[model samples]
Target: MTATLDHQPIHSWLTDMDGVLVHEEAALPGAAEFIAALQQYGRPFLVLTNNSIFTPRDLRARLSRSGIDIPEESIWTSALATARFLAEQKPGAAAYVIGEAGLTSAMHEEGFILADSDVEFVVLGETRTYSFEAITRAIRLITGGAKFIATNPDVSGPSAEGPLPATGAVAAMITAATGIRPYYVGKPNPLMMRTALNRIGAHSETSIMIGDRMDTDVKSGLEAGMRSVLVLTGSTQEHELTKYPYRPTAVLDGIADVVPLVEQLTPHESVELDED
Candidate 1:
């Protein structure tokens, strides 16, 4: 429906990465052109993700391997949002972090001192392997009066074998143990979307939020006042849309289908390869 005559004029854009642009390490069709369209139109945009495992530099390289060319500055992750949130809440605070390089790097960049104990916050993120030792330390810290923060709320993610426990699942275990709920700072939270929009100088009204999941990307965008687009390329399916209380502005098969609409949206734009 994106290429139809009744399409709205989108001044800026935000899109999810995994299912919308690439799936299982392969760039989906039209993923490249969709990004090209945004640049051609001189539209300020950011690619959003709930995964906090990789930094933008890492993600940029991964996307490149999949044939999608996105600059490091154009990519936004839960780690970045989490870091921004912590920094705003308390500059130079200490945190007991449980995650990978993405989360740790973000905390360090935000002037957070990684503490062994007696920290202000317990930060959790995604990792290939969840350590009992690490989670135990996190529980101990949170129970000791440190605030609990998680990058995203996703319970499981797809893998070659099957679904694997994600950050949310681990957070649930911590919550169950300590009787404390961790503040999720990723998608489905308006804070993440608003932060991304602010970084790109885009307004929710003029921007479009595109994603494969209705629960997070679509819902968060709608809640943040942006037009939402539900793509049927990932976790959420067509039959699932009716289950949600809210709806996207439009639905499309995948990002590949967005190419024509993008071409039309930036007719006068001098499209170029953005290599930053």
Candidate 2:
């Protein structure tokens, strides 16, 4: 457990899952207690994530497996926002996707038609099978006047071996081959942030976004007009904050520190310090 800091009253919160809640199948230290504090206070929050590999239900199930029980509706994923964008931009239009089952299912559910030929849009997300044929097809479609869309611009994701290339790598390949840029729909993009706020029915002034990445999560919150808190449990390091163009409203070691800060700000809650 970590010590908390003094903070202002926060009515709602938006958090990133991979680093703040759990690293893999195991829950992070003090994650359970942090969640319990939120539940006890009845604070409305949403677990917003940039990983489009899984659906909300799938993510909720994974969290449950780790003893973090969160409702499905409270889980907002990049896939859902990306699909919604596609539906609004080109209704009933054909799209060629290079993502996993989650992205494909989301688009289909949004009433977008999947076309094997003559695709108007080429959507890119994370996929295990990055075959040569698929890349060739995406290149051909883009050359034939198709618009490109990317779920996120993140180049890599954390793995046991370290960071591994993600959708951004594939998008880069397509861009190099087709000479076109993709419109991002994930974190750091206002679209995903707006979708999260809408789902939680939270006002920008009263909401706070907490995450480990500065470029994606913190930047997204700042751009969306919400308070941003950067946690040093994953991608970001304490020393790197000075190099970034933007800064978070607050900084902490992890989610555990957030509880005391929130409790300090709220009138009826009390906090006591204990060394682990």
Score residue 136 of candidate 2 by CA lDDT: 93
* lDDT tens per residue, model 2, 69-107: 888888888888999888888888999988887798899
For candidate 1, the C-alpha RMSD (Å) to the true structure equals 4.7
Among all windows of 10 consecutive residues in model 2, the one with the lowest summed lDDT is: 267-276
lDDT of all predictions: 0.87, 0.82
Residue pairs in candidate 1 whose N, alpha carbon or C atoms collide under 3 angstroms: none
| lDDT against true structure, model 2 | 0.82
* Superposed model 2: Cα runs more than 4 Å off: 1-9, 261-276
Which parts of model 1 are misplaced by more than 4 Å? 1-8, 266-276
